[model samples]
Target: MWLEQMLAAAGRSGAFYEGKRRAGQYFLRYELPRTEAQFALLESLDRTTLDMPADCI
Candidate 1:
């Protein structure tokens, strides 16, 4: 699941131009591990939090 999210973000980064010339631009490449342990480790650093109102629950 975490890997999927990472790949999706990577895809949104756009394409890569090796020898093309540009004024001032850059491209980043994101690589995610394919192992469950790796995903767990990555997710542990950035866990999400949910907030609910007192009367909502």
Candidate 2:
């Protein structure tokens, strides 16, 4: 599974961060595009636009 591979890679690469969780959950969620158009729109955005303000995470 892609999620499993991603987690494994993160663990091996020391990229994993600890986060709060509820019960047995990992407290992480994935948001997938509902349609191809949404995906295309997201893909069209320039990477620079994704940078956050220095004060904001």
Candidate 3:
């Protein structure tokens, strides 16, 4: 969806297209993989949060 939008924007402006293209590539390369680790960490959460001692708050 975003790539399609970026490509559409390329038809409108070169600079805007390049910027979005580079940003999207960066996100896909560097940021996308973080979701796996983040989701795994999230999945590890069980009752620990809810069971925390009231005094800690």
User: In terms of TM-score, which candidate is strongest?
Assistant: 3
Tell me the lDDT of model 2 at 30. 32
Residue 11 of model 1: what lDDT? 30
Better of 1 and 2 by TM-score: 2
Per-residue lDDT tens digits for candidate 1, residues 9-57, read 5534433322121211222223323456778878787543345565776
lDDT values, one for every candidate: 0.41, 0.46, 0.77
Task: State the TM-score for model 3.
Answer: 0.67
When 2 and 3 are scored with TM-score, the better candidate is 3
Clashing pairs in 1: none
Which scores higher on lDDT, 1 or 2? 2
What is residue 41's positional error in candidate 2, in angstroms? Answer: 1.9
TM-score of 2: 0.24
Judge candidate 3 against the unseen true structure and give its global Cα lDDT, from 0 to 1.
0.77
Better of 2 and 3 by lDDT: 3
Where in model 3 is the C-alpha error above 4 Å?
1-7, 10-13
**TM-scores of the models, in the given order?**
0.20, 0.24, 0.67
